[model samples]
Target: MSDGVKVIAVNRKARHDYAVDETYECGIELLGTEVKSFRDGKISFPDSWAEVINGEVWLRSLRIAENPFSSIFNHDPDRRKKLLLHRDEIKRIARKVDEKGYTLIPLSFYFKKGRVKVELGLCKGKKAYDKRADIRERDIQREVSREFRAKLH
Candidate 1:
């Protein structure tokens, strides 16, 4: 099968704030109207997260706009959606979270093979110094690239 995945939205802030250790690609369960609205690029969430509860993974805080054409049959804007993942994988992640300093965050949202998929990251909160150091390193790399480009001219 072709891997023609179309990315829908990304939570860039999550990467800057957390150090990701592992990632999982999951299929999301959505209502018909919700999916319609999502296709129009009307979905976003600032503090979204995933949690393993009762042996299942659930996505919380995701906001999908109501399709204007749906009338009174629209789905809730902020609803908990189930994520499809292997049982063993869920257990493994749960163990890691219970150990402390680990969190489950939605890294990105996309469509794969005409279906909605989410990239979940197992992350640890980064310290203030860590973020500052990352900024310094990025600046250095950018400056070096610019100097080389000028010299080549």
Candidate 2:
């Protein structure tokens, strides 16, 4: 977190579906109009994920909505944006991805010093029982907090 950073969108489903192990801050290659759209909060990462291809990380299924004012030079809303990451970082992440059940997921997007950045998470999909356990743990925590608040009042 810094002075000029502003969060644009977050993929809540990522947290619900995956057990995030590590995070990476990476840059996104965006068109001029796409930046405008992002600033206006017209972006989504519903079915989106990242992949390492040819030693580069590519963001797939990130939808930046079309800017209405930018008529002809608008970028495609469904383009696979390229991610800017260091060579060693990409290789490390790629190796982790090659593991049996690991994948890359975009957790959130934001602006850092006027440049858009994506928070990429190294995650593994959760089993049904894992998800249920998470839900149960959350419920127990909520009840404990509620009881503490009641005693304080």
Candidate 3:
């Protein structure tokens, strides 16, 4: 089977604010109208995250705008969604999250093989100095690329 991946939304701030140590791709429980909203690219996840609750993982703060055609049947825009993960995987994630400074964050959302999938990141919050250093490194990389291009021409 061909693996077709179509990205729906990405939380760009998550990477800048947290240092991701590992990532997991899992399916999310979504409503029909929510899926339609995704197809329309009407999704926004601000300050969104995931947490292991009662042996299950749930995504919180994800906002999928209601589909115009769904009227009364449209899903709630701010409802938390369940993330489908294996029992063993959830247990492992819970253990890791219990460690100090580690937390779960949603990195991106996409459609894989016609089904919605979530990319969850196991991350540690970055300090202010860390963010500054990242910006410095990015600037240096940009300059280096510019100089390399100039030399080639």
Candidate 4:
């Protein structure tokens, strides 16, 4: 088996807004049209999240645009898609989510072995100060890398 998954998109803002504790790769149940839409890069992860219900995980608020050329049928852009995860993993996620200030956010979407997979993160919301600090640290690192490159030139 190869680990070369074709990543579709990553939620860059999710990392900036939340402190991710762990990540889990889970399969997504999608319609044929929805899969085609994703292949065309017509998917958005804005405000998307995972939820454990009835001992199963489900993705909510994911937007996969319809295939405009297909007039006969169209998949809903926003639908609750089921996620394939083990029972123990679901239990662990449920427990983590029940804790105060913890959340389940979608980190990225990708295709692994011809299957659509979503990377879900167990995260805690970051405070305003934390966001500012991250921004400052990123700027400092960017400046250091630039100086290092200039010296090599």
Highest TM-score: which candidate?
Answer: 2
Off by over 4 Å in 1: 1-3
Q: Locate the minimum summed-lDDT window of 10 residues in model 1.
A: 1-10
If both were scored by lDDT, which would come out higher, candidate 1 or candidate 2?
Answer: 2
Candidate 3: segments with Cα more than 4 A from true spot: 1-3
Cα RMSD, each candidate: 1.6, 0.9, 1.7, 1.9
lDDT of 2: 0.94
The TM-score of candidate 4 is: 0.91
lDDT of 2 by residue, 5-117 (tens): 99999899999999999999999999999999999999988889999899999999998999999889988999899999999999999998997668899999999998999
- My TM-score estimates for the predictions, one after another, are 0.95, 0.97, 0.95, 0.91
Assess candidate 1 and give its lDDT.
Answer: 0.91
The lDDT of each candidate is: 0.91, 0.94, 0.92, 0.90
**In candidate 4, how many Å is residue 106 off?**
0.6
In candidate 2, the residue pairs with backbone N, CA or C atoms under 3 Å apart (3 or more residues apart, or in different chains) clash, namely none
**Best by the lDDT measure:** 2
Candidate 3, residues 11-85, lDDT tens digits: the string is 899999999999999999999999999899998886989999999999998889999898799888999999999
* lDDT tens readout by residue for model 4, 1-153: 258789889999999999999999888889999999989989888799888889999889898999998887988888899999888999988988987657899998888888888889999999999999999999999999999999999
Better of 1 and 4 by lDDT: 1
- Clash pairs, candidate 3, are none
